[model samples]
Structure formats: structure tokens, C-alpha cells
Target: MVTMTVSHKRKDALKDVWDAVSSGWGSVTSGGVWSNAETEQEFEARLQRWENSGLAHEEAKRLGQKPPRAPRGWHKRQYPEIKRGDKAKYGVIGWARAVEVTRGANGWHVHIHAVLVLEGRQQAHERAYALGRSMHVRWNKGIAKRGFTSSKEHGLRVDVSEGAERQLAEYLAKAGEPEKAVRNSVEKAGKALAREATLGQHKIAKRGGRTPFQI
Candidate 1:
């Protein structure tokens, strides 16, 4: 654990970060439940639970099949390629940084990670807020689409920062894990022979590509 020594000052800073994330997600949808970005008033009402384990156990359970894990911490990162994908011939936008796809009852929830470069730290924050409005800009008549909101009561979060070089490196390294979940599990099982006990069964072939007589 990082110990997360959060002072009131740190809390305020992180709140700004979270607001940026929520607003950006909302803007992508354009508006409504799909772009359900929480406002200042909403946070004022629910900050207690926000400081707590996200929501109560019931809500967290609803988000995950088993007990939900702690919410993933957000960070800003840099990628020379992601920032200049066009020149690299990869066909990606500079503003787009990361994305997360998750399974749920309805379907997969696709979360985007965008890191737009701004002038400075203050400008970075200002742009972060502005991005929130864009979350709903995609809605019909500038209305939001679905598959975004957490529920009626809460909204998702967006985090933005200036010069995310370190953050981007970490996200990229870990990104492979979730993307290859199924493939990884199958590979792991094939490599290990789990032990089982029965009354008579004892010595056996290594299963390490061994012939019966080799034992």
C-alpha cells in the first residue's frame, strides 16, 4: 500500500482529478444517464460514501459478480507513440491514452482513457473540467448514449494531468494483463498439475512430457 497519506489538500486535488474523469466520460456520450457525470452538488451529498469503500457492499456486489475489489487508482502517463500515433503509422489520436473494457449483465462497459495535452498544470486542470462537458456532447441533439453510467445515484470518474510520462508507462505495462485474462488462465492451467488425493493413488508419471517407463 502507498499509505495514501491524504490531507485535506490532497483530497481536494484528487477530487479535481475525479471530476475530470467523470466529466470526460459523460461528454463522450453527449448527455443523460449515459453521460451521467456527477456535479459539485452530487459530491457534496455523497462524499462520505466516496471516502468509504466506494459504495456500500450491496452496490459494489452489483458491480462485480463476486465481492468487488478496491477501486483502481487513476494516473496520468506519457507515451510518445500514443501522443503522436499518426506519425508512428498506428492510426490513433493524440488525445486518446487508455481504454478499459469490462463485462457486466448488460454487456461490456467500455471505458476510455484520454490524455489531452494542455499548456501547463493549471491549464491541465481547466481542460480536465472542460472535457467533462464533452462527455455529453455525443448525445442525440447533443444527447448522451447508454452503457456509461454506474447507476442513477453515482457517475464514473475521469482523471487528467499534464505530462503523464511516468503514468503512461505504468498503465501500458499493466494493460496486457486484463486484455489477456482468458488466454493467461488457460496457459497457466496447462503448465501446472494440481495435486489431488485419493486412497490408493500415489506415484505417477511426471506429466512433464514423460514416458511411463522413464519414471
Candidate 2:
């Protein structure tokens, strides 16, 4: 059973992961990867699972016991923790951005706009393909028979460059806007852990592709 809670420590852990990804150190690139779902059915199903997991965890906590064991494949929606010991797989940082809306003609529409920073462009593409396949294989049925399709795979849409820093900062800012004190605490904790760059403060070259010190 995994007990997931929103705490200062957890927030800091997330900040550290975000800082590593935003730095783009060692040949990093960024892009949006769309999941391979011909219809939103598969994505919706996963969301239902996520919601149910949250409810179960809350219920268990209320009973003052260890949280119930999460269902298989439940980690897909949680924050991707970058363990210091796993340098190889931890090279990527990512998040899923999804929103649901009701359209007059289409009813409910769910769109997934996941973003990732990878070691390289080639790696970015390869990783996106793998992510799409994993999501399909994990939650969807008959993936072996129908196989995978580009339409259902993540689309390569953006190449994050120097300007990505600003975007990353914006993302972090928005993420913790609800609580300034907690956000500051997380930043401090993250910087202490990373010991490289402070959270949300690194000055990458600006929008013109030149650092402030550049002439």
C-alpha cells in the first residue's frame, strides 16, 4: 500500500524533479506528446481509475490504517519521482496536462497534452512512442491484436530550447501559486537536494536566445 499525501517534503521532491528537467543539462530537449487514443475512451478509463484510487486512499487514511494497495498500473498518473539511485531512467522529467470540457455538439471532450524533457531529440521521439505504447498496453485491451498507430501515439509538437526556461518557470509559478509560503519552502528544499540550480530562478538565455551577460 502506497500512502500518497501532499506535504512540504513531497512538494520539494516534485520541485527537484522539475528543476532537473528545466535545466536541460546533458543534451535535453522538450516537446508535447499526445497519447495514442483513437477515441478518448481509454484516457477516460484511466482517469476513472485515478479518481477511484484517490478515494480509496482517503478512505483508508480516515480509518487510521495503512492505505489500501493501489491497483496495478496506478502509478501512471502520479508525479514521476526521480530517484537519485536511478540515473539512467531518471534522465527524463514529465507531466500530464489534461482538461475536460463540454461541447454543445461533442458533449464531453478530454484532451491530453503531456509534456516531456528528454536527453535528445531522437530520444524524445523514441520516448514519446514508448509512452504512448505503455499507456495503451497498461490500461487498454486488445492492444496486442490492433497493435499501435501513429494516430494513437504521441505527436511530436514542440522543441524546447533556451526559451524553455521561462516556460518552465511559468509552469512552476502557476503550480504553487495557491500557497506562497509552501512554494518557497519547496524551492529551498529542492535547491538543497539538487545542489546545482535553485528552483524557478535559473536564468537561461532569454527569448532572443542570448543570456543577460551576452554581448
Candidate 3:
């Protein structure tokens, strides 16, 4: 019974995607997601490139010369390792994910928030840990292919909770109503269950920086 607000125009389309992901699920054992962070050197190099591009464009305009075209298809050039991981045999029964991006002192950050439904209920913690480790390894390899690297410790996070499934169901059911009263209630409850399945992206940022929402 997950509920979310939608425009009158896009409600039907959103529902179709939701139905496909959440149709058949008995229980949720663990919840997890993946993210990669850049090194300081990588950040500086990218920033320098951006600044240089801006300067070059300005110079060309002043001289009445044709401005250089910015690099194109960079995202396309980077191999999408996550897509391959999604197709791997990971004992995943059903899953849903949203790709998110934000910028901070560390530069642009891209990550995935996902809810994975597993096949069975026995030894849930052990299973979740194993899965998390495996995911971390796979993620590292994938990011390397794209010329990025993340810490082994902070790359992937998986949490196991006995009451995760019920809390998740409640959170999803209340998260997307347009009414002011309903939205307030959902926020209160969502913060209480943020570590479980809530999709709000207000987590505190590392390195003494504020998250995009905070800024």
C-alpha cells in the first residue's frame, strides 16, 4: 500500500512503474544502497578543467573567434558497471532503485538508493552481510572501470533489522500525499525510520560539509 503524490498528468505513469517493482513481496530482511566518493586529487583536476573551459570560452568570445565545443558523451563513454551488476546472479527476488546526484565540497556525487527483496528468511543477518560485502567488491570493480574509486569501508552499506519490513511498508504508504497535514505526518514518521526504507535524502554529509537539502 505504498502511496506517493503525483501530478494529475503523470499519476498513471508513475503507478505503472511502482506496480512493476512492488507487486510480489512477502517480507524484507535487509535494506542497502551503493555510492562512490572521489579523491581530493580527482576533484581538483575536474574543477581545474571546468575553470579552464570557462576561461577559454570567454577568451574566444573576446577575440570574435568560434568558441570551442565542450566535451560530449562523457557519461556514455564511462562504462555503466551497475547495469551489469543488476543483471548478475545475486539471489535478488525483486528490487527498486533511484539514481541520485548532489554536489558538495567534494564535487559532484552520484549514487543509488535501492530496496532489495531477497528469496528466503533464514539467517537474515549473515545473508545480508555476505551480500553487502559482495556488492562492495562488485561496486569497486565497476567504478574502477569508469575511472573512479571509493573507499572499501564506505562504498556499500547494508543494515539488517527485525522490524524493517513493517516499518518500510508504513513509510512507503504515507510518503506521497499532497495534503499539508499528510506530508507533515509522513516526515515525522519517515525520520524515525530513515535507516530502514525511507527515501528522503537528508543524511549528514561527511568532511564537515552540508548536504544539498541543508544548503
Candidate 4:
């Protein structure tokens, strides 16, 4: 199980990751490509498992249809650590850059939908892919294949491109607001979905697109 409490060293390390992502990187960030999924039904099944096991719906949403699942990526809530890494890395490497680490859950495997952008799409992806591999190696404390998409039947997904950062931020802001104030906002979003919800559109609202539902 993941530790809910942070030790001094852990806190410091987290700060380091935060610093890497937040530095004066750039307007465009490089994207990391990693995906894992089985089927739509399977995805929902994973979401249900998370909810049943106490994970928030926000986390489940991240586990949308995808492939190379995410680490510590359980359900709807988006993990800031993933995006933070991107923000820290590419923020300095390119012109206009941002990272979007989306979530997805399924029996197949849950992974992040990461994206990075820079002056050019081509170079941004190349750099982002290499960096992702390096980070995975660093974080996991081992060396692994580093590239834009996974190889050996794992590269089928892992979306990337511009606006991914903003898009992900907006998504998290709506679904997984942290404090009570923000969480209340996300709850309101739930109510909004109950109201404006369309057929097969019962998924959570767009992060920034919808206002928090009122009581």
C-alpha cells in the first residue's frame, strides 16, 4: 500500500520533484507517452473497483479508455507527481511547454495519458520520450526502455500534444479538488453531472468547463 503519511526525506524528495516541474521551463512542455487499458466495460469495472475500495471518482475518470498502466494510478483522481515531473523537466527545455498526465483504470492496466509540447511537436516528443524513460529509471531506481511510446505491444496508446497540460489541470481542478473548499467544488461538479448528464455522458464534467454544482 502507498504511504499516506510523508516522512521528512519523502517530503524533501517531493519538493525536489516539484521544483523540477515548476522551474522556469517554458510555455511548451514535452509529453510522455504511456497507456494501458482493456475495454470500455473493463475501464468502468476498474473505476467501480476503485470507488468500492474508497478511491474518489476523480481518480476513476483518469482511467479512461487506454495501454503500460500508471504507477500508483488507481482511479479517477489525477496524480500531481506525474505532471509535476513533466512541468519541471520540459518547462525549461522548450518554448511553449506543459505536461498532462491523465489517468485511466482497467483490468488491462492503468497508466497516465501524458503530453508535452515545445517549439516543435517532433522534437518535443523526442525529448519528452527520452526524459520520461530517464525519470522512470530514476524514480524506479532502475534502467528501462526510454522513448515516446512503449514498445512490445505497449505503444498502442499514450496520447500527446499541445494544451495537454491545461486540459489535465482543468480536469483535476474539476474532479479532484484537494482541500474541502476545492473538494466541495468537485462535489458540486458531481451534482452538476447528475443534472446535465446525458446518455452515456455520465462521466465527470470537464475540469474547468463546468461550474461546481450548488447545494
Q: Estimated TM-score per prediction?
A: 0.26, 0.25, 0.40, 0.21
> What pairs collide in candidate 2?
36-152, 36-153
Stretches > 4 Å off in candidate 1: 1-93, 139-156, 162-215
Q: What are the RMSD figures for all models against the true structure? A: 25.4, 22.4, 22.0, 24.6
- lDDT score for residue 3 of model 1: 6
Where model 2 places Cα greater than 4 Å from the true spot, the runs are: 1-90, 139-215
Clashing pairs in 3: 4-176, 5-176
Alpha carbon deviation, residue 87, candidate 3 (Å): 9.0
Question: Please, what's the RMSD in Å of model 2?
Answer: 22.4
**Tens digits of lDDT, candidate 3, 1-215:** 11111111222243332232222111122222322344557667766676677667768878999987543433244321222132133445665555444445544444545556666667756766776666555555444443444564455666554544554456557767446654454455434334433443656666765555756
User: What is candidate 4's lDDT per residue for 96-138, written digit by digit as tens?
Assistant: 2222221122111112222233344546556655555543433
Q: Which 10 consecutive positions of candidate 2 have the poorest summed lDDT?
A: 1-10
CA lDDT of every candidate: 0.34, 0.36, 0.46, 0.33
lDDT of 4 at 18: 31
Give the deviation of candidate 4 from the true structure as CA RMSD: 24.6
Instruction: Give the runs in model 3 whose Cα sits over 4 Å from its true position.
Output: 1-90, 164-198, 201-215
Ranking by lDDT: 3, 2, 1, 4
Whole-model lDDT, candidate 2? 0.36
